[model samples]
Target chain A: MLILHCPYCGVYAEETELHAGGEAHLKRATIGDSDEAFEEYLFMRENKKGVHLERWRHANGCGKWFLCARDTATLEVYGTYPAQTTEPPADIVAAITAKHPGWSWKEKA
Target chain B: MSNAVSALNGQEAKGDVTVRELGLTGMITLRGDFEDENFGAALSQITGAGVPDVRHFVQAGDFTVLWMSPDELLVILPYEKAAETVAAFDAALKGTHFLAVNVSDARALISISGDFANEVLAKLSPVDMSADRFTAGMVRRTRLAQVAAAFWMLPDGSYNLMCFRSVADYAFGLLSTSAKAGKVGAI
Candidate 1:
């Protein structure tokens, strides 16, 4: 039973109450950008076993979209934030760093 | 919406629970900024109750305005007044980014009373159904029996559960089966 905390509804919803949306916070590459950039935007998505960020929707609950930081292999959820945020909140990143040391994500030192 | 008998219309299968399909009750889905100066007052005018905050409801007579989300609410009114309520809201807020839709015909409401109503709902949903966690006037938008539904708990301990009209049969079946199963150990 995978449980996710929906920031909007303020409820820890089970997987049945949620729909998993794949990657989060990807910059769109449109016309005038190089083919490589467009391909990277459309085709290249992360399938990480360590720390990762993804989109999720509380479809059966409040029907709001949110973001989740989790470890894919261990299924240990670090935290969840609203989807409108352009980046993961600081505390979430810090929690992921403290648990899984030497993790690599975008723009994280 | 439809006054047709629900799938579980007359079936009372050995339990203290009394499940009845409520007649066509009016419903509207209203979306607006509660922070807007004219929003709450206009909603109160239509529903005859003070505007409720998110995850709660304000009761007025038999009508209740339930807060569905930060910017959305469900207005429960008389069946004949569903369209009238939406029209009134549209006329009231003529220049706001709001959506007032009449959903009376698109949803189904059923009531389950007696001692087992709480337990039956708890079995089907992830919400905390205890009296302390879900008190009166608290409206929760949660899943009921594998379908999306909203629960409005009244002060008398009865519950009015609403779901999409298309899933009325499924909702009724799940509720009846769960109600009966709670009565005895066997199916």
Candidate 2:
């Protein structure tokens, strides 16, 4: 079972106390956008095997939603940050880069 | 006006630990900027207790202030004083961006006391309920069995648990069952 730290309440909650909210930092397509763009926005996902960013809610704890950066294969948590942030914080990016080396969110490592 | 009643009607059970419903506790959900001087001052004045730190609670006189989140607090006091206290909060924080709502009737309070109180709670919650880890003054808002609940240890080593009123009977049943299941002998 995964153990995650909730940034809002500062509690190290286990997987049972949290709910996975899929991918993070998704960009919504505007009304004028093409059908292809809307389809990509709605259905496409990275589903990367390595470091990934996801949203999680402290469902049984503080009831606040937050973002988590972790390795999908190793289950190593890079860091956790508040949900209000549009992208991963500099520190989280730095941590991920240090271990994975030249890794970026959308680009191949 | 109609008469007010507690969810469990003050039911209790005795086993390795004692589980009892603490009827009609006054609770106020306060949300705002904790750093604002006016907010702190008004809360202290109304609840007679200062703001609690992260995952902690503080008691003064008849009130206890629990740190619920980054910008939220749960103030517990005598049931009869809930409305007047909300009014007082409104009066004291006239110009501040804050929310103080009476949640006394919307929730249920239960007490578990005995030498094995920690074990009883440890069965239901995912928290570290050892005496050294979950000592007095700390408050934890987590799941109790399948429901959301918050609990804090009193100075007397007893535990006070709070959950939504609708689930009071379920919470009571879980507590009593846990109490009767025998101690874990670890905590």
TM-score of chain A of each: 0.92, 0.95
Tens-digit per-residue lDDT, B29-134, candidate 1: 9998889878978877767887686688888986888888777888888887877788999999899889999888788888888786888888888887877888
DockQ for each of the predicted structures, in order? 0.66, 0.78
Question: Model 1 residue B32 lDDT?
Answer: 85
**How high is the DockQ of candidate 2?**
0.78
Q: Candidate 2 residues B1-187, lDDT tens each?
A: 9999988989999776999999888999999899999999998887879889899999999999999988899999999999999999999999889999999999999999998999999999999998888999899999998999999999999999999999999999999999999887986
Q: Which candidate is the best by lDDT?
A: 2
Steric clash pairs (candidate 1): none
Calculate the i-RMS of every candidate, to one decimal place: 1.2, 0.9
Candidate 2 CAPRI-style tier? medium
Candidate 1: DockQ?
Answer: 0.66
